[model samples]
Target: MKAALVNRKMGLFLALAGILALAVAWWVEHVLHIMPCELCLVERWPWRILILIGVVDILLPGAAGGPVLWLAVPVLLTSIGLAACHVGVEWQWWPSPLPGCHAPHISGHTMAERLASMPLLPSKPCDAPTYLIPDLPISMSMMGGLYAAGILVAFCVWKYRVAHTARRIFY
Candidate 1:
């Protein structure tokens, strides 16, 4: 297949993968009642961004050429960074920021009110420092390592295809 065609195919695959990841995240949060921590929410953002980029690239192959690949690099890098940060938080290597999203509890509420309000608050806060996975001893933050690995794979594949095509054209 031609290089451009191959890149377009790769873009489509990446786009689909991103969508599936988002779907899984939703299922985990809404259906399984697994509340995501602040960092987990942050991690989802890059996946969404990557999904957007991949879909756009697939639809407009020319638009996703040289300049667009450069844009993807940062998106992938940001994903890795977020995953790393989550892993760090899980390991207690550093403290997470506290705020509405990361706040463990709200003041000025009765016990019943607090119980009722628990679901309203983001399920897990950054400072709480633990994630529960079914049948797993490790926390969800450790799962960030898996996310980082996946991002690295995607980045390498993208870079390889782009560079290979450039080299072929130049020669």
Candidate 2:
């Protein structure tokens, strides 16, 4: 097959994978009521950006060929880093800096006010990781790790195809 055709195919696949990841995240958060901490939300942003990049790449194949891969590599790395950080936080290897999400403090108020504000506190502590599938013990942040793996795999496959195509054309 032609290099252009192969590139298009890979771009489509990446876009589809990204879309599926986003849908799953939404389902876990909205439909299943698995609330995400601030860090979890931060970890998700890269996936969202990657999905957007994939979509744009698919729509404009010429723009995606080489330049987009350069863009994707760093984004994928950043996502993996963020996911690792979240895992560290969940395991208590490191503490999260975000307030309200990572640390809960008693409001400065009288006893009556504290009693009235009891319901405002989150039921789940920020330190606690929320899992989409509780039986697996894998939190959404860890799931982001899975997504990063997919992105890396996609990147490798795409790179291989590009290199293979270039070799065929030149030699």
Provide the clashing-pair count of each candidate structure.
0, 0
Candidate 2 lDDT over residue span 1-171, tens digit each: 365566566667666666777788788878988776777667767767777677666666664553564566777788888888888888988777666554445564699876766556364445688776648998777778877887787788768877887899899
Candidate 1 weakest lDDT stretch, 10 residues: 98-107
- Look at candidate 1 and tell me the lDDT of residue 15: 74
The C-alpha stretches of model 1 lying farther than 4 A from their native spots are: 63-66, 101-122, 127-138, 161-171
Predictions: Cα RMSD each: 3.9, 2.9
TM-score for each of the candidates = 0.73, 0.80
- Provide the lDDT at 38 for model 1: 68
Candidate 2: segments with Cα more than 4 A from true spot: 63-65, 111-124, 133-135
Maximum-TM-score candidate:
2
| lDDT (tens digit, per residue) of candidate 1 on 1-171 | 365676676667667767876887788779878777767787888778768777776766764542454555677678767777766666677877535445555454688776765655445656454445656756555554476467658767777877887899999
Candidate 2 steric clashes: 0
Error of 1 at 134 (Å): 4.7
